[model samples]
Target: MLSNLIRQGIKPTPLIVCAGGTSSRCAADGLWTVDLRARHRQLIINEEREEVEVGTGLTMAEVLQGLQPRGRSIPVGLSTIPGCGFVLTGGIGPLTRSQGLALDHIVGLCGVWGNGNIFDLSAPTNPASPGTASKNETHQQWKGLLGAAPFLAVVTAIRLRTQKLTPLVIWRSVCSVQQLEIAIEAAETWEHSASLQWAWNDNIELFITCCADDPAAMEAMQSLRTHLGYCPESSMAIVAGQHAQPAFGTMARAADPQERIHSEVISRLGPAWGQRLPSLMADLKELMNNRPHAGCQISAQQLGGASAQIPVSRTSFIHRNAIWKPWINATWMACDAKGQESALAWLMRANNLLSDYCPGVHLAQIHPHLSCHHQELNDAFKNWLPGLKHLKSHLDPYGLLPPL
Candidate 1:
């Protein structure tokens, strides 16, 4: 269908493989839209190689379900309902520090470029895969698609390097700002098997998870637990035989099913941002005190470990030095136009608050249809945007996809 549309001099408005984009953005002015959610829904698990080839339509939840019985799972973010679009940009969750971002786990991709061309960039390093990038052109496309696939092509499927499904020990506590700072500082030195994630709303909720069977990781988890003075009996949830999914459900806040949620995941992807994070806590506390509404809040997942070790040039997600992906979310009642305006205004204000602390951004959720899209595009890729634009021109010159 995409090839036919492109061949006929028609761009499909924007190829709709949602990677966490909002409904309003997709339905903007109700332009001629094409949703390929059903086109590629296959999930093939290569047990010997320990990788999962997931089709574009599969939700994170479905992926986890299939991997669960196999004793392997990939790192997926909160609310696992999103399609592969979740990973194309970046997907961060409690397992991030241990397993790395979901995108980092992606080894191969099969997609149709904007110009009606089909390309299958399989993982050469994987013994079960069939291709290697001996040529300069194919090499660049592999890197290009990892972090920018949604904007450059119609991705039909992806191959992910799945991780061992180990026991997870999770602890959550309502922390004061000072305790939160202490936890964040302590997290920086924790082992790769341990991670911390926190969110701020009516109260600041902090959760730490560890693959507790690892003695060293459990030790770090205990140390942080002791420092926070958490009541072990009440705060800990030990899913001793489960992977990430079960543990996360115990800690995740349930959104009211009725209200509309519009949010952006973001960060100043830069060096030593974690070291500077605590310094902003006092001011952030003040901002939370003055937030526009009860629905407006902030959350962040820790990043580093295996993720930071990879070279930035290997993918479009350039800010390898970033240790935390903190973002502000603003939500409102669906029918309240004035509330929507205020909520959005606060998000912009909150973004400006953290912009100077870092030199880059995370297009965590691609928002090519919004006002922040342009600013985020320029900043997210920084110097790399020019090269990405040149690549986009080659693969998607018809403006058939989102802006770079």
Candidate 2:
């Protein structure tokens, strides 16, 4: 099909590919739409390699459900609705501190680049595998695909390593910003088996989760929880593979059918930004007061642990030291131009606030809105754009997919 377009000296209109979810995608008007869900919904688990190969169409929910029977799970974002794009980008979840980002599990992929060339690439899982790739070109392509596949190719399938499923002990509370700051400080020093996440609406709702996979980690979780004080509102026990995170479900939800939401995700390396947390929260609280819409939200997920062990050169996710992933999500009623402008302006201001902490942007989703698109890309891909573009020139010279 792609060949026919090239043969006719034609190209798909600038397009959006729906791998499974629409939470972060923009409008489809005047653009070609490629929906992969209907035809690509297969899931297969290979016990020998302890991996599962998923069709790009599957949502994280479906993948987890499938893994449940096998007693295995993969680290993914907060909610399951993100679809495969979640992994193609860096999938940061509460378990990331212990398990690493979703992209880190990708062992192989099958894809077609922008220029209609098909290829299969794999990353070695152990020393016996080819890390010192006998074929240097293939090695480079493998690294490029793990985090930046959406920009460089149409990935049809992915093979991801899975972990033994475990139960998570979670607690929730509504706390003062100062308490939240203190919790953040303690979390930074906590064991990787635990993670802290919070979102602010009318109040600051705090959530801290620890995987009860081992005795030592459980001890650390208790120490941190005690230090953070009491939580009047706690949660029921949850087996990690049995359900999606109930706390940050909003992050994965789209607006009403008649509404639209836009998000600007930002990340900053930690150990350096720790001291400024108190002031940052205060600034954010002030900013939220003037929001044009009540639906806007500010949320953050802690990063570090196993994620920091990988070097920046390994994947397109260059913020190897990032210990905080915070985002400003702005939404408006459908067709409300004035409201849209206000919300976007508010997001820009929020980004500006984050920039002060030596921020690195995550191109979490495409920004078809030209005004912020180019600038955000520059920030997100600093020092890596030229190398990515060189690959694009060879693989997608026709600009068949998204451009940097």
Off by over 4 Å in 2: 1-12, 124-134, 240-244, 249-272
Candidate 2 shows a clash count of: 0
Model 1: weakest 10-residue lDDT segment is 243-252
Steric clash pairs (candidate 2): none
User: lDDT values of the candidates?
Assistant: 0.73, 0.73
Evaluate model 1: give its lDDT.
Answer: 0.73
Q: What is candidate 2's lDDT per residue for 1-404, written digit by digit as tens?
A: 64444334434545567886554563356666567787778899999999999999999989999998888989877777778998988888888888899898998898677777777788844422455545655766776787778778878889999998888877666777777787777777776577888877666767767786666666766776677677676453555652655746332223333445444444433333567877887898798788777777777887788888887777888887888887777767777779878888887887788777646777677775547777766676778878888888887787767776
Model 1: per-residue Cα lDDT at residue 382? 79
Best prediction by TM-score: 2
Estimate, for each residue in 1-404, the C-alpha lDDT of model 1 and write its tens digit.
66776667653476555533333444445455556565677889999999999988777877888898888888877567676777887777777777788899988888789888988887435333445545556766777898888778888889999988777787777777888788887887775677777888776777777776767878887777777784533377777333343333233243543566555445556545565776678667877887776667787777788788777777888888887777777777777778878888778877888776656788766677568888988888877889889889999888788767
- Evaluate residue 152 in candidate 1 and report its C-alpha lDDT on the 0 to 100 scale: 88
